[model samples]
Target: MKSISKYWSIFQITLINSLAYPGELVGRSLMIIPFMWIFYQLWKVTFSAAGAADGMINGLTLRDTLWYLMLAETIELGRPPIARTMSENVKDGSIAYILNKPYDFLLYQFSTAMGETIFRAMLNAVFGGLTVWWLVGTPNHPEGFLIALPAIFGAWILHFSINAMIGLSAFVVEDVSAFTWIYQKLAFIFGGMLIPLDFYPQWLQNIAKLLPFSSAIYGPARLFVTPTLELFISVMSLQITWIIALTFALAIVYRRGLAQLTVNGG
Candidate 1:
């Protein structure tokens, strides 16, 4: 209990620190507005072009599609750059100081990452939701937000696990920019950030759903639009599976990285 409180304190401190620059936080979140606008325009055209007699394409209406995208953007943009930050810490030798602290490094990073993610995600949801509302009205299942909340948290955990693994590579190679870049592109495509996985061909959808990326972005966002109890269970189940798998993978990487870690600061 006492040890848990320590990480809780770290989370609380970082959460407060993130708000120390209110203007910057809000400004960064504001970028979601333009992203939502562009998505609305792009999808509106695609929907029109499809011209489904029932006004549905791939099991989603335009409004559903827009709302889905807003949530997806919120999740993606809300996350802090954990891999990059870790890489930088390694390069600068600040990681040595962090290691001296009496806390598990992985848990400490998780606490800080979640602390940074909370307000950014909320702000993005607010700004993006408003923009999407103006463009497409309210979501089909407004209650879905509450239902999807747990999955959203799970999504972040899954994201952290994967990213921390990439960051751990910093112990071997100082620059992980290439790795992060590839990860981002894979997420954009397989996680359904730009287009919902339902819109993909059947074979592609199957492939994407099998990947961990879908659990991070598509699962929660899709549940937000549909919001069925069964879907919630499926999403959470898959997310938890990935979270467990990736977390174990991350622990292995962290241990190996720590072995290779060499800090040279007197």
Candidate 2:
């Protein structure tokens, strides 16, 4: 009870703080507008070129693909710079202050992120829905909203942990931009950000399925469009498993990182 309350306070504080900087959320969502437009045109051209080859490229029409793209964009944009901030804190010794706090530093981070993510997700859905309506008039599968909720939450957990792990790497490497960049690209490519993983070669699909990247953006967004009981269970299960494993991995990393910290002046 106390723990929940304590984190609840952090969550509330972060939520209010986000309002102070309303532009960030709006700006981030707005920035995706142009990109979404570009994708719309590109996909339209591609589908036109495909021209009766098949309406389903890896179980996606032009419309379904656009919907999937919106979800993917939202997830990617909604992520706060957990890795960047943590890496900078570690580099500058500011993590000392965070460590001195009563709550777990990672939990504190997660709570703050959750607040921001909730706000962003709501706004992103609105903006994305508008954008999709403008371009393609209802991207299909309205029922997916329900099926995707748990999967998206699970993806958020996995994303947070993966980023925390990258941030913790700063303890040894001191700079993690390269790592983050690579991770983002891999998530974009293998995670099915640009397109569906099913369109990829069988070998690539196998590799992507094995990685958490697939579970995060790809799997959840895929769930939003596909929405089958079996697929939902499979995606959610993968997301849950990745959440547990990545969180366990983060615990180990944070433990070691804490041990390595140098605390002196009171």
Clash count list over all predictions: 0, 0
RMSD for each of the candidates: 1.2, 1.7
lDDT of model 1 at position 110? 98
Model 1 residue 189 distance off true place after TM-score fit, in angstroms: 0.2
User: On a 0 to 1 TM-score scale, where does candidate 1 land against the true structure?
Assistant: 0.98
Please give each candidate's TM-score: 0.98, 0.95
Model 2 backbone overlap count:
0
Q: 1-266, model 1: which lDDT tens digit per residue? A: 99999999999999999999999999999999999999989999999999999889988999999999999999999999999998888778888889998999999999999999999999999999999999989998999999989999999999999999898888887789999999999999999999899999999999999899999999999999999989998999999999999999999998888877744333
Q: Which ten residues in a row have the lowest lDDT in candidate 2?
A: 257-266
- Ten-residue stretch with the least lDDT total in model 1: 257-266
Q: Which is the leading candidate under TM-score?
A: 1
* TM-score attained by model 2: 0.95
How does each model score on lDDT?
Answer: 0.93, 0.86
Candidate 1 error regions (>4 Å): 262-266
Mind giving the per-residue lDDT tens digits that candidate 2 earns over 1-266?
Answer: 99889999998988888888788768877877787899999889888887767776766898888989999988888878889988988888888788787897999989988877788877887887789878988857899978898888888888899998999889888899999999999999988888888878999899998799999999989899889999998898888888889999999998887776643213
Task: Tell me the deviation in Å of residue 246 in model 1.
Answer: 0.4
